[model samples]
Target: MSVQAQGREIRILALGDSLVAGYGLARGEGFVAQLEAALRARGIPARVLDGGVSGDTTAGGLARLDWALAETPDAAIVALGGNDGLRAIDPAATYANLDAILTRLAARNIPVLLAGMLAPPNLGAEYGAAFRDAYERLARAHDVVFYPFFLDGVAAEPALNQPDGIHPNARGVAVMVERILPAVERLIEKARS
Candidate 1:
């Protein structure tokens, strides 16, 4: 709160997939937009750049890290890996890609919030364990903020998702923004310090 008095906007890179991209929602209804609105509502001078690509996997996110970094964020949110899980890619490869992404950001001294994704249950328990474990490791190794399960309150709830049942609608996005706000605020505080 009162972050605006610091005299510059806190730029946060929302790097991830359709969840961060706000796939089916209208322009302002997406994650970045709603998050920015929430930050502003709390009197924090911040802007959340949307680095989400509709179908991006962890590999895709690693591939485009430079492009997203072009915004020169003060802090970042890593929300990738959903596409990788959906595609049932090797968890090892997914872990490597995410590791690279986190490594790069760490090298640059940018604080990050690593948003975790759980593998679909149908993927089998072993796959799910390996997939979800990567986030924890990365968070500990890189010393980043970790918010487990990006779709925590919205996942599998028909009322919170769009017709496809994969992406959250506006209401669901609101829930996400609400739940993730504290972590983002902590990210902002870290940036200022």
Candidate 2:
């Protein structure tokens, strides 16, 4: 922890779509809640703001970023692009929107943990390749922490996901939190520093 941040609450903004919104999960079972709990468990005084919206795309995330910034977060987690991939939105558009989001956050001096997403398999190999690589590109360009594939251990697992197979169940959320906790810790350190 930075000397200046010794005793204050660390606010983290979580921006994304249904996965971040926890479409089917209950309030405490969502990603943000679980992540907050995990942070606290590690003795980190942090609050994660839920900026997720069901059905939101990268364009939507960009549109709402200003409002989200009103929270004045110390750090951010950008987890968008899932809906864009699901809808087969243009890779260039997705990349542009994400770049804008990261750029705006950087402008505010907020550290970020970019949660990545992959293109839906049915979107074709060429489209998938383009979509899958945008997050890494953005992470390198912006010099932010990156968690490639937000659904790492949970996606495509019949037991880990809800019946819709798109959203993770409570257990899946737990798994996600477990996998991303280290990165989040790093993000908090960045914020504190």
The superposed Cα distance between candidate 2 and the true structure at residue 151, in angstroms, equals 0.4
Give candidate 2 regions above 4 Å deviation. Answer: 1-5
Q: Write the per-residue lDDT of candidate 2 for residues 14-93, one digit (tens) a residue.
A: 99999999899888999999998888877778899999999999999999999999998999999999999988899999
Against the reference, the lDDT scores of all candidates come to 0.92, 0.92
TM-score of each: 0.96, 0.96
lDDT of candidate 1 over 24-143, digit per residue (tens)? 899999999999999998888788999999999998999999999999999999999999999999989998998999889989989899999999999999999999998888889888
Query: Could you tell me which 10 consecutive residues in candidate 2 have the lowest summed lDDT?
Result: 1-10
lDDT of 2: 0.92
- Quick one: how many clashes does candidate 2 have? 0
| Superposed Cα deviation of residue 37, candidate 2 (Å) | 0.7
